[model samples]
Target: MRPSGLRHHHRLETRAVTRFEPNLRIPGPTSLPPSVREAGGRQMINHRGPEFAAMLGRIQTGMRPYFGTQSEIAVLSCAGTGGLEAAVVNVLSPGDRVLGVSIGAFGDRFAKIAEVYGAAVDRVSAEWGHAARPDEVRERLRGGDYRAVLLTHNETSTGVMNPIPDLAAAIHQESPETLILVDSVSALGAVPFEMDGWGTDVVVTGSQKAWMAAPGLAMVAASERAWAAMEIAQMPRFYLDLRRHRESARSGETPWTPAIAVIYQVDEGLRLMAAEGAENVFARHEACAAATRAGLEGLGFELFADAANRSTTVTAAWIPDGVDWKAFNGEVKRRGVVLAGGQGKLAGKVFRVGHLGSVTVDEILGAIATLETVSVTAGRPVEVGAAVAAAQRAAIEAGIARVPVAAGA
Candidate 1:
């Protein structure tokens, strides 16, 4: 008696169901805000035009406070790894001695890049879940005349953030002339970094991690000392040359064609971050991290990272015994919650939850609820809602107030 469309509408009205919402819980390429998404869809612009120059200038200025530097910022059209390569190629000459302080996989990669570029790379490695202690670094620096030392500000693979200030101080004290090159790709915006204050020479970061933008641009900060190195250091470089980037940036341009759309997204993302205030943004990340850790603890999951070294950007937890990791992940995904599996040596042992870049405590609470539900579906039943409740308390305790979804978070 009714048309197909009317019958379909009648069937939908007869039952209750909620819309599917996906939570992308990964270390990087975080979910974007609506305005950021719209900005990224803007029509292409001439790379050398005035409009692009103005936008590039704004981004360069906006990035200063987050980087805690007044030094030159080179906006390169590449991922974070490319930025690290730039740091290596532009600063040190072939056969230069380098110390790589590795806490996790990314840390190792920084060293590997230096080695590939012909530097004599020696490593001071810490256990996977722990951070590199200052004492060990101090001891190592005392023994060698290292030209530069590569450090990771945050190791997302293991969910650990190194004590940069302390490590930098130790390096300077032991080897005062050694340049401090930091890979802050996963930490800069989410965590606090003081490039000049900490005497860091080069700090490289990416657009995707905490900037709430797509994976296209790698931003690097170079101190005066680092620029001086560029004058004499002789590692072969053309495309990833910081000197070229620095020169072109004087006119608000990139060395090559830039990722125009990603810059648009970064422009909007920087605007959102500025409106939120830097301190508040840091606090929000802290609150979300605390909530995530508390929630995981409530679910009887052992955290992979050490308590004192846990990263605010991502939280890694051990996959519980008696539960199939693949099955558990599938269940979580089926419910529209996508979590990150462990990397490197932790491949089958841990799972990571990313909570940064416009992520709110409420969103984390939802993910926690999903995890609790999925755990039950996997036959590991615990008290329902306990993890969510724990997360709520932790967030509140971390000075987070309930905020609107669009309140510049």
Candidate 2:
């Protein structure tokens, strides 16, 4: 998908001063860096040409370190969900008993994919707003001989970041032979992830989240064990086949005609990300998330997720008791700040503010100011500027600047 326009220009608001641009503060399809946007609009090249190969090589090599893996990562022409499906189809055969460890919506989707493909899936679900605990998975694995264990590193729906490293360790301790598949679509780049260190067999992610690019591309990293599992897998697969992508990557190509523009976009985005350094990028996300949570709490809004397990990429908060949340989001949208309403059972109950990808401290503060305006206009109770002040204080305590350096400064 293409990016929504990101502008620094201002339009006077009669009701309240306009805070930011048309803020696309949704969970996915986050705002892209201007350079990535520029690169994506460039003329498409021959997918099979040497020029594409060299570009693909740069992207692949640059991406390996983000997931903390040296193994092969296959870039495909699909959304992040496709990467999850590829991981499923590549590892388990039909009728293979597997454990689906679910935290929220994405975890459930991963399980559904495995079941639809004929894997006998058993689910271990965590409470909504909480992460799947390692002890629970360990307890379940103790009793079952599953072929694989599915996990979501960060559950976007609930704004909970699972303890993957601890969970992976638990899985390894209990079932050494079982494959560990992770759907880290919204978490991998924006959050801390370790595929090799955590013993994750397969990890799936997308371009749209924290990669600072447009949608329509999925990146999948498979361990040697996952590749070994592909050899004996009998589940039906063609387009979502990891083997095809893996085999083609050796020649710096995809099995199908890929989204060449997105590849170019990710290459440029990764270049910018690498220049910033991964730790700094991750730290930036954490600081923004902290600021957001502090700001939201200061607005007298309760966060949806458990405080200890909140995600760094998105902060989901409950809509005030007397306000129409859907209308509130629309009001925020009207203020030129687009916030994400919740998914599944959470629809109209919670709102998400995306701080992933290319958002800045000043931009987040703008969104905060917009929320205050929307709250006041919608007649919901809020202390004017209290949230922004809390956020600014939190940022300072975190060693993050309250204001951001403007682009091209």
Top TM-score model = 1
In model 2, the Cα lDDT at residue 139 comes to 96
Give per-residue CA lDDT, model 1, range 1-409, as digits (tens).
Answer: 7899999998775432343557888988898988898899999999998999999999999999999999878899999999999999999999999999999999999999999989999999999999999999999888788999999999999999999999999999999999999999999998888999999999999999999999999999999999999999999999998888888988878889999999999999999888788888898999999999999999999999999999999999999888888987877776677899989988999999999888889889988998898777666767998989999999989998445233443
Clashes of each: 0, 0
What are the runs in model 1 whose C-alpha is more than 4 Å off?
A: 1-21, 401-409
lDDT of candidate model 2 versus the reference: 0.85
- The CA-based lDDT of model 1 is what? 0.90
Per-model CA lDDT versus the true structure: 0.90, 0.85
Residue 158 alpha-carbon offset, candidate 2, angstroms: 0.6
**In candidate 1, which residue pairs clash?**
none
Local accuracy of candidate 2 as per-residue lDDT tens digits, 1-409: 3333322232233444465558778888988777788888999888888899899889889889888899988998999988888999988899999999888888999999999999999999999899888999999999788999999888999899999999999999999999999998998888777799989999999999988888999999999998998999998889988899888878878899999888888988888777777777777787888888888888889999998899988889887788777677777777788888888888888888888887777778888888887777767678888899999888667667322211321
Which candidate comes out best when scored by lDDT?
A: 1
